[model samples]
Target chain A: MSTATQTMPSVERVVTPGKYTFGRIMPEALKYFIVITLAISYAFPLYWMISSALKDDPQVYRIPPVLVPNPAHWENFINAWKSDNFTLYTFNSVFRYAVPYTLFTLLSSSVVAYGFSRIRWPGRDKLFYLCIGTMLIPYTVTMVPLFIIFKHLRWVGTYLPMIVPALFGNAFFIFMLRQFFMTLPEELSEAARIDGASELGIFFRIILPLAKPALAVVALFAFMGTWNDYLGPLIYINKYTMYPLALGIQKLRAMMSQVGNAPLAYPYLMAVSTIAAAPIIIIFFFAQRTFIEGIALTGLKG
Target chain B: MAVATAKKWRLSKRETQNLITGLLFVSPWLLGFLLWTLYPLISSAYYSFTRYDLVRPPIWIGLDNFREIFTDDPRFWTVVYNTFYYVGISVPLGVVVAFLMASLLNTKLVLRSTFRAIFYIPSIVPAVCSAMVWLFIYNNQYGVINNLLRAAGQPIIPFLSSVEWAKPSLIVISLWAQGTAVVIFLAALQDVPRSLYEAATVDGANALHRFWHITIPMCSPIILYNLVMSLIGAFQTFLMPYLLTNGGPMASTEFYAMNLYRQAFEFFRMGKACALAWIMAIVVAILTAILFRTSGRWVFYGGGER
Candidate 1:
């Protein structure tokens, strides 16, 4: 399907190369112009963000708005970092949430997904459907009670509320990984079993090795979810010092009101946002292929 | 007879082993469902009927919370309206934008992947970061948007602060992240057979006709998927409004999820929040069911006759 669709345009190009007229050429040029213009408009905010982050107060508030900073004050980032105790917040974000959450979710969800995809047992299919059904239950239904549960356990105001839940597999990740695992040939695992391998041995040797791309997708998703999550950290973590980068940035903005320096703070806030957004942007560029594939698989299959 | 009985016993033992192994592998999710998902679901249902503040034990109040939400609280209706307004506008708008973007990008062009990446990059940016960037863009004093307006000799609109503009501003922000839907739509577009278009062209169908008949019909399933998913997402829009306007200059941007969050956490009205959660959940489920039911009229499956 893909190959046929892809080759169609090239074939048309070849057939009509010498026959190009104003009617045909004009629309082609127009298409490219529109696409490029739309792409620029789509990318403008990100460009503005990075450029504004590097601008000083005057540059940021310039009448026509400077497209780029003249001097490009690099100190805005330094000041932003220092102003909000963002260094410590970065550590809290990384260690307290993103890393642990990703690692635990990947490990646990993959294991559970392996069972759903590869294992044969009574009631497995029924139970798996039930698990999938939970995806329909909105998080609003879960949030308050879970908060009460954690509060009773004295886990609020700590990273435990965020970290502990991830240790148990998330339904979405489990579903995604299971779908990926199901696409792998069953004969491989069966062969491993005949070679005196236990189920765990087959999972470890045959399945996990072959599932690297899918695992990478799951890991990337977990990283983004943890890093980008605002509400979870907002509800659970009360201490300013314990804030993840998301909540920390929010707090920094709110605190800017107290400092009463909207001009200076605007650039600093933009600087902080740029810094916070850097990792995922870098990851997206590098892992573009896997990310798109993962998105397509989830959307189509789900 | 003895040998056959012994073999049967061994077969049963192996079946037991299979069950045990499967259970072991799936234990984590099962435990999580019980502790986190199922428990919370049931507890929330129970709490919805009670009057519980965080500081006190829940007092069973029957339908009072529901009654209050339905009849007494004017704020509740405003939030409901706000949420519906958001979902109604954003979901359709997002679907249209994403479909158009996907169609545009589907053509043979130079730097196609780069363009796709640029469109999709914003979707992956942390919502908090995106909200912060938008806050700067919508700044009335020196925002990028206002500056552009001023350059064009137009009045600067108060985006987040003004009641009329707040919801629309959020809708615009939601549309910015429609890249996920665009990518999905692109995948769907590529799956459309070239022969279908060829056949249409041979029948003297123009570009518009081909897009309307061939491309749109073929991509309907994905478009519906995007529609349903975005509907659910729009209903739950919290972080953007919460961070951007803090539910507003007069609660104009108070989405359903934001109201629930504030009720539970900020005001400590745990029981009322629980009730609100259940109501929102039902509304979502009903909306989703309605979409699915109506989709049969439009959605075209690959193997089926149109």
Candidate 2:
């Protein structure tokens, strides 16, 4: 087992098959063609989203649909922003919800995972397994009762219901970080302890620094989960002012109908969707290695 | 002497200190489980046997909600059918598509990461955002799908609005996010020992035969993993239908979760909703158990242990 910081490139290089023949070349070309086609199809919707966001109302309805925006309507973004209280929604998403949620989830889950993986104690494995077992219990089973509990605490309308839970640690994240924590050599912690370092000191000085990649993965997942959470906000926060980008975007189309806006709202709505999706897409590009590695590790170990 | 030994075994001082430290570190999750998960789970079960709305205290009414769900509620059956329809079609199709894409990407190619990222971007997109985008794409008039159809001289199909098209439309939306599965399968495919394929090739086995015999079996464990995961996900389908169509003009796409949500919130039927939730949990558990049981026949671990 290696430190979490060690990068394992996912691509495996296979030995090239003997000689290239026309028979092989034809199939190889065909394989590339199919792969390209699948890639194009997968990317097409995202392309349409951006292009449609740029097209003006009339151009959007052109008989032969425009593959690209001829004159990109950057103003559509302005209109989309003005169409709803998206500024408020964006603030709620970033400052009020995602930032705090990600921070708490990453910090707390790491601490819990360290306890489970690094420290030896009676019933440690059993307690960790108990935590893992809860993952199989679908959230739907608990949604109604939890809603009632929050309501009784009068936390429903506030961000507390969504934000407070993250401090408790997520089971899946605990499992992931614990797995990564276990991979680091135990001798480092042992050496730290022999030097008269406390458990907290060892965790903070040695284990935490070594587990940056895994911590980053956990943080990324927490950010994404909080950013895209629909049902949580939908259930707990009833006021329009508390809506995150996900629920806010869901309400945009209906709000248009209530305002008796023309059907040309499609382009503007597309602009809003593009705005909502851009942060995640940009983050993906920047953190491509972390994102791919996280997915691969979870798949392998899950 | 035996009594003294038993007393000594109870808690050595060092063991007591270790236990205290462990408990202190894990207290956050422990407290959370006690208050949030365990309490809610037990209460939900208790509430399922009672008649309660939001305002009134729950009144004991054992099996009534279950009886109504099984026999009286027509919408319950409709939701069951719709869920099964979505799960049956989407899970297998998603697995095949993911496996195929993974296989294609496993070959030597240029900019493999770029291709992988392109496929994966959709899965990371916020579900509500993707639903909104697809709603526009599936718009009957002045939408991409309709425009393409008109150009091909085909009739414009009402995708989100029409009962016939809504469920299938939702399924198509789900396929857009199968990139997670593709990445998983690609990792699994790469783990398949290349020497096995070479040995088969030396034995004059063609590419198809090698793939059929070696690739599929080696990846079967992951296939089962993906299958069970997708099955559970499909059963809990909510956001797409909720955002795209709001369960549609005729409840055509009213998935089980959507119906459960509506019952709990919209209709204020808390007890019945709890019952529905319990039933969904049971179905998921049973399906997962069945998959695990049958996995012994097909799913092959690398070490030859069933």
Candidate 3:
């Protein structure tokens, strides 16, 4: 084709199909349109959430549904905050989801993943497979038995049941970190071994520093999972004061269920949803560059 | 004898040293897994065969729980049917949507990262929050969706509240959250060597034909992986259904997991829930094995022997 076009430019222009010109441009235009539509569709619900949260209950349900609130009800957030015991709930959420569990999952899963990924010991491969096997077992199957176990241990209605499981290396996190570790050059560790460095010493100085990307991925996923987890807190943590944001927000719905014929407040519920979602949104914005990179890398591995 | 003894002692000491290190590294997970995962896993199997409530001691009644689940309970078959309906419909839909989104994002367009970020924005919201948003959208009286319908001069359709629309509503919600799968597919799509497209173009193959012959074949292995993963996820679909309908409109969305939750938590039917759990696990394991077997024929690996 190149040779033909070079030989006779005008003849080539006449011979080539004009119908195909539109075909190329049309597909590109359609692609752009679809991408734009999908972006709007994906973001609309979240936009609605914020708008509805600020609007009055009556105004929230207005016909041709209002896109923007007339008077921004910033007070709704403050009112919901005070009325819903959000301060206590936020404290509980932080304690359960962020503080104790974050450090616990990071410290614990790293140790376990290090053993499986770096160590050469008896039954290593077998034990590693056993850990991966847990991923396939649905959480539904284990919930009932675990509840009973907790009930027996007198651990129900407390943060212990929820917090304790995170101390274990999650199977998904282990698998992910292990995949990243396998990609690291063995020569680094080999040199450390020759220097009479202990495995723990090498883990601290060599592996830990090199594995920051994987560690960040681990921490990001753990935070997201723990933050979004509803079932754990619902089943195990029974007391109202012990509720995390997930269960607490759901409880707001439960309260709405009893308010009779009158319109229950929309602003309060919206405020709760926004508040609950803020941390994740902030985390995403801060770590987005690394987060997407991690996602792209992990997605390929899977 | 003394030399042999000394050598044996040295080997034993080294073995003990390795053992100690291994234990120290794994102790956090080991202790927690035994207490949480493994212990529960094994005891759940035991609990399946016994009759027990939360307060009472587990009674030895072999096969009774299983027998009841198979023959006696009305909800067992209903739950299974509902679960299969969700999984069977959602997995293919989710896969197709994901692939389409990936293909769109794969084009050499401007603001590609922005496009990727925008599409993936839905996944960042917690499932419950999205469910709450959908609940408002699905409201028949004053919902944004109904208002749109009203403006269009069309009849309002009851979404989550209607039994007929409940499953489809859930599926649609799931498709919105299909962003994660799309991200995976997008990464996989990049690996489809650009040379293949160039070759196809030279051969007078159009975009559709090129996609059919080259792109699909190259990405088949990933498609299979995503299929199995999504199927497993869809089967255990709990969060959205739990938050949206609470398995309502007369248990219209009473998925197998939701049923298990009600039995264990609400009714305290520990034994029966355990039985249901075991059934779900077996089904999942069997389905996973089947996928693995079938995948070998279709899934293309890099320059490897069939």
Candidate 4:
């Protein structure tokens, strides 16, 4: 049924010459041209970011920017790493956000999403709708009040303000995961149920293993959100030592700019940015298929 | 009343257990909503009516904040107008570009996946990093864009620095980094039944006509989704203008969010900032409601109930 409809567009277009046959060559050529141009345009900035990190401060603003450096300066990365205090900041970031939220959000949200998806719970639809409706209330509306609430709890400047939100389970993530869970055959869970497994046991043993793809999506998104998040850390984190990489990087810029003629060493900043992002980039490269598929499935719900 | 009481008592024990279990299952969300979501929402509304600045207790201000926003504050209306202008232009332009790219890539053409990936690649670049790169590109002196323009015998234009061009410059950057929307569109396009197009073709419709008449209508739901979200996103835009213009060059790109951020954080006007956020949220909610009402006329859902 699908193939018959897909083949019609093939009939009308004219054929061409040699390797570029009219029937096929044009589409292929057009595809290649568009693909190559787009790939370069997309990747070029990232390439420049890395290149700028290596180039000396003097060469940073060279007219008609050089694409490649002659002798690569590896020290720029080392300098950036040291100056930005990325080691401490990255650790703080991981401890403050990645570690806490990963354990918290995944365990809590997945369980919730599973229950919502699989259970024949009364008022489930109403509850789910209520949660989803919160997505309409802009994050800005929540920010100030959340700040005040955290302050009253003496959680401001502590990681709790940032980390504790995970306990609630994000609405959008739950919905996305629930949708994916709904698509799974109920028989598997039913079979498990009949085998004398408790609901908790089934969730831990059978359902979780089957839901790795969705879990990975959730984890990747959570990690990225926490990592690149500037505003949250800016508002909550006060002590310099408590600062995450996002806040730390901004401080680095401010400090560097303040000290006049200190090489304006942005290569280091660039290097830090690259390093900060390296883990996600490496993971993204490896799991491009699953990640893109997940994005498509989730519809950028966050 | 006696019968009702008897009926309530007559409910099955197993059914009552299930109800308790269901509440247990949803307890996390329920508790969080009350503690975190509901409390904050109410507190924010209260804060909007006060003159709280974090250090001091909130003073009852009645409708002063709203009144000030409407009349006394010179730039409040301007910022709102600027925000709407940005949303008005950028959302449609973004949808059209994304749609065009999605269509072009959604073919039996060779290396289709590779093409799609290329288009979807820009979104991975950190927002700040992408903004910085565009800043360089929009540089009037020796920028690649202006250089190219010169080569084409066009006049050199001040892209980001110019007040008239700043928002548009940001829009251009937005289009470049629209990998998310592009991917979504492609996915929606993939779901579009090819049989509709084949039927249209058999009826002697040309490719362009079929695309306009069939491809577009079929994908209107996705378009509506993107449009509403993009409008919301664009209005709440910060970081770019904050980093690039610093809301400078006479506050040309002084967006509502940026203005709110300045008021709250910079000047420590927490109450006013809360008011601004509330107003913005209300505006967005209304706009979204309008979009939802209009969507039924244009949006064609494939699977869901009418």
Off by over 4 Å in 3: A1-20, A261-264, B1-24, B30-32, B304-306
Clashing pairs in 3: none
Q: What TM-score goes with each of the models?
A: 0.94, 0.95, 0.91, 0.89
RMSD of each: 3.7, 2.8, 6.7, 4.5
Q: For each candidate, give the TM-score of chain B.
A: 0.92, 0.92, 0.89, 0.90
Every candidate's lDDT? 0.87, 0.86, 0.79, 0.75
lDDT of 4: 0.75
- Candidate ranking under TM-score, highest first, comes to 2, 1, 3, 4
TM-score of 1: 0.94
In model 1, how large is the Cα lDDT of residue A251? Answer: 86
Residue runs of model 2 more than 4 Å from their true location after superposition: A1-19, A259-263, B1-12, B304-306
Candidates ranked, most accurate by DockQ first: 2, 1, 3, 4
Q: List the residue pairs that clash in candidate 1.
A: none
Residue-wise C-alpha lDDT for candidate 4, range A251-282, written one tens digit per residue: 77667668863573466656666676567667
Best by TM-score: 2
Report the CAPRI category for model 1: medium
